[model samples]
Target: MRDDNASPDEPGTSTDRSGLSRRSFLTAAAALGLLPAGGRAFAEDKLLTFEKPRAFSFDLLADQARRMAMQPYIETKSRDPKVLDQIDFDAHWKIKYRPEATLEVADGSAPVRLFHLGRYFQLPVGIHVVDGDKSRELRYDPVVFEMPEDSPARKLPKDIGYAGLRVMAPDQKTDWLAFLGAAYFRSAGELNQYGLSARALAIDVAMPTPEEFPRFTDYYLERSTTPGHELVITCLIDSPRMTGVFRMDVGKHGPVVMDIDSRFFARDKIDRVGLAPLTSMFWFSETDRPDRIDWRPEVHDSDGLALWTGSNERIWRPLNNPPMVRTSSFADRGPKGFGLLQRDRSFANYQDDGVFYEKRPTVWIEPKGDWGAGEVQLVEIPTDDEIHDNIVVYWVSEKPVGRGDEIPLSYRLTWSKDEPHPAEVSTVTATRIGRGGIPGQPRPKGVMKFAIDFDGGYVAKLDRDAKGVEAVVNASRGELSNIECYSVKIGTAWRMTFDIKADDPEPVDLRAYLKSGDQTLTETWLYQFLPEPDSAA
Candidate 1:
């Protein structure tokens, strides 16, 4: 399975805010009288005002995004090292936002909360509130958020800015939306356990050059009259390479969704421009597991990369935790949609009660306009555990992005289990891997077996002796044998079974999808088989 946890600052140093150190803040908050006493609430105002915007417009934000792309990049640093020094993981956790301090905004007037800076997040960000056509910035004060008497956050200075912002639902007890770090933003998804994150844009990810992370330097929040729909947020993105303005429309129905529209201004030349970029973790699965030592059967935030190309083909590519960084791109005229999906939504698969992996939501992105010619790219990195994120997928455009160039992007982000695009044909439901050979005969050396199940439409019509139904199997460096196609008697689906005998350790590229004569019955299922220890030639 994949990993969780936001990218905090570097580990070890007490100054780094990225969720590493713990003990410093407690000692300091006690000396400064910032600690909450015996459940007593700290007296602090939840709402305050910053600089007010005369007018609010999406175009204006886009213009800003475009304009920033033309200038040199500026890096934001902590102003008060003493306060930033005191704020660590434990200190940030201790400085809780007062329930009464919640700023009532949209969603029929619900309070929105703010996240304070800590060791994991030391840089300051501007927070603002928008009401109707008016917008104002919020002041950061130590008294605004109530904390424990011994809490270290109280020792921090008043002007230390917030790391990010979060929006609460109708009830102020829980938050459903959070814009925490960088361009990293996410809703609780459908399952409420924040799974994958959608970024504003991806620049040079998995590139040989150092990756550049753009930050939302400032934000403007405003309420809308639409019921069920809460506030509209306008974010100002700044980086060394580009600047962008984003308007996010957030709401809740069956699940939370963010309708994002933005314009980007490039300040420097970019080798790779990623649209609708998604970050996820894929640690281990049945196919990738070296040894089944873990108690939990399967582990991963997402199982596959689901893509609906402009060619009207739905493709499912399962993720892998490769030995090194691997990137794959599928060229298309205009991608209909794509996303990193958590397809296996069964508690039985992940047995983790504390953090229910099954309930994690799958995010789908639908481009609003003609994306032109671009390829959806998938990047996978090797990870030993579920702590580091290793999976990334995004749409890359063919056109070059240079300084002063303005790019407009709009997309609908869906946080749900099932994708909106309905498939007429049944899809690959499960993939299982095991050692080849029967119990009676000696097992063939360097042989492996794969069992794949297709659960839906065309498969239900397949007969045990179907005339046209056939399994097409291909390998990169191996001989295929014992290939068989059969209709499972218990279910209304067909099964494609195959075994591979490889002479070398090179990975075998396997492609299989249901086909009847010249007609294609199912989406292509792509898998890569890694050679065993003793199989290397």
Candidate 2:
């Protein structure tokens, strides 16, 4: 789940991590000329001072992680839990970082700011600045921030450390990226909205046993030579069962692009370890909407999971808000790529100007090298609203990892409005579900109807009236009938409608694709069907 400064009562609410309100802060900064056009130049008044340098490298960090894993894992406790409790949501908002204290790095390439420790984030992290092969630790100081006179944070120790850190624009007001709460981080993509989050690693997620969240104990921020272009960040992750090192090269061209290199060492055997895991919210969508659930037409950070297999087959699976926890796995060898995509880009589809669901970025995971045999796992947890993130997707290797095993992995993450590598075949545009039965006939108790839309690529060139175009569909445990396919009036898009007669209450797995003669013209569409509560009983 993506952690923000929101209170428990305001779960999933978007918060500005720059320690200030979004609109007022940006407007004021711009008016003062602190933020120039294109958001590239910074004021000369703020500069970062460096302490004595110490030698550092990636190998040294890996060695440190290995040594840490050899010893017993000790959990880091909060120094002042009572003080953090007093600095709750309301008080935390009142505390802000001093503008003059902003750390200007790489000669105004990107400004840096710190997040104060609060109830949601009790464990502090060590932060440092890197220059070439040398680095210096940045100590915590209460004078760097401005808090209300009555704020509980003022009473805390001067060296309490920071909860997290954020990378801001040259203005030091609008932040484009942040790392906070566990090994989790997110970026405001090309559209500048925070939705889904990417975690460093996930251990035993959705298993019978409790899940484990690792912590980023330390961070090293490197100075970039190119102004307003890129930044390098290295993190040391620690947990009870594992220790790891991560290096990320983040570029802010338009859509945020991150190249990640990670290595892990395990203290104990882990059967279920998720690499490059993504977490998002999926409360409701057009496919299955309860009566007047909310005012919005759809509410979700991402609508579908797209996969490109090694054999060159494309697949699209629409997301769901299931009644129970559900796990789906797609096995592959040397897979090309996969990601959770926000395919729907129309504002009318969401009708949410505040959150702008239509602008949520689609994050794609591209492997840097051959990732041997593994399966892409998708876990859907039951959620009544958008507050709780209910969707998680990750890649799990088939080979088991045991204690003392050293695992190295590398991948590139693209946070954009669309998939970086799109399929040449047709694509699934939308999915809709409703009651199954003839319009005038009595409705069937144990039946359902589905309408799937396919557009673009070869399908757009072929005439729908012409023969040979077929809807290849099948169900795992149901009778499929009354199939129909036609072109919609708006564009060259084709719609396929079908009904399923599910005599039993068991869940059904359905797959469909567009084919012309022996050639496949569209990517495969997969969906899961769960019977209504009354019918299931």
Candidate 3:
């Protein structure tokens, strides 16, 4: 993982790239104020310098991406890696942008701040401000940044360039959104706590071959003219395998929302192209509490993947921390939307009050146009600690992508405490796993119990002692037993508990839902159970 200098004292964590750790991403700009007390205005010295203006447009950027795809890829290199490498976490934080030097777009509609290049982010990304049909590149100079007396960043060259950028709040102490290493970006959503990261695109993810991380090489920031929209961010992303242009219309009304338009040009055949990908952390929740060694009862940014299929079926798949890397694909056509949700907002679930996991935002992906024939893919990588981001979910179109292909996908991402649209059917509240057989009897070996809860919608109004409730269940490779459905003694929610004897060493895919006679009472619950030898069954 690669992230540099993101302080642990910060509110949210960022997923690391090659040189950075997962916790190093967001802390740089999430809550820290760049300026020291009473830092004077640098406007008198023309702090925000710029190069000559050049005509720019999303269409032009997309066309350029297509042309770039036709030619061999040229990678960007750091001007002085040795010096940058010395700018580690502490030193990098010392070099902060001066508040007075912040760039104001369209007469201060949005304020933009620059990030200094550091060890993890050695290669510089161009920063530009767009006005009308023309855009001007911001000049990088030591004058804009405040460095300590002996900061390592002082050794860098004058034109070493910027690493990334963030959109600042009016207070300037905290940032609402930030674009950092690789193609990753994160927004401090309605809760003002950063948890997950969203990427422009993902290539060859979870494949046998190593994954490729494309970089956003340049950015064009502009003020949004729309009433609700605050900023317009356009970027040019490049890699050996693909090139693309993404335009994001971002607004911070309650929940942070970004309306994104991505145009990609494939330079080579892609086995899997993940569109609108979201990267998160799911270490151990109530579902895997028995496997956890940490003191916290639960720890995760998201607990489940909520999907609305093209066939009008709503599914809730609880996230798992598998024994190995697990990739689950749900096939559909003209899909509606999908998102990773953090339903449990109770602070007691995660006792570590430092990071406030309870306030982490749930990000939902909403497709703009018809995304025909695709699979919502969830790739979970095993992690023992919360420092690593191990969960990634995205929409991958079934259509094979080859060189010389031009594709355009548009979607909106909403980061909040709940989904943009709540489920019409009762939604899953919690999932727990433990011993399979009865408590007083000898527990069956190779068997595991699954306890799932669902509340709201049609199920909420039903009687707690309803006699005809049924659990529609299915297992890919297991003998299911102890199937039962009843009302919980705690809340208005209904509970569905069952046990499956999965002898196979491989994972068992299971599905169940609460139903009354012929009518479905809750959204379908899907899970993958990994068997553990010599454990309670």
Best model number under TM-score: 3
Write model 2 residue lDDT over 97-172, tens digit each, in one string: 7666666554565666777787777889987776667777776777767778999999899889877777776655
The residue-by-residue lDDT of candidate 3 on 1-537, one tens digit each, is 223222322323355521112334533352222211112212224666678888889999898899999999998877888888788766666566667677666344446777777777787898887778888787788888778889888888888888888776655656767787889888778987777788898888878777888889999977777779878899999999999999999888799889999999999999989989988888898787754388888888788899998898999999988777788999999888899999999998888767778887899998888999989999988888777788889888889999988889998899998898887889999888887899999977878888998998987888888888899899998788899988888779998899988665678888899887788889989988887755424
Which structure among the candidates has the greatest lDDT?
A: 3
Query: Is 2 or 3 the stronger prediction by lDDT?
Result: 3
Give the runs in model 2 whose Cα sits over 4 Å from its true position: 1-51, 224-229, 535-537
| TM values, all candidates | 0.88, 0.91, 0.93
lDDT of 3: 0.79
* Per-model tally of clashing residue pairs: 36, 0, 10
Local error of candidate 1 at 417, Å?
A: 1.7
Please say which candidate is ahead in lDDT: 1 or 2. 2
Question: Model 2, poorest ten-residue lDDT window?
Answer: 24-33
Q: Rate the local accuracy (lDDT) of all candidates.
A: 0.69, 0.77, 0.79
Query: Model 2, 530: alpha-carbon shift in Å?
Result: 1.1
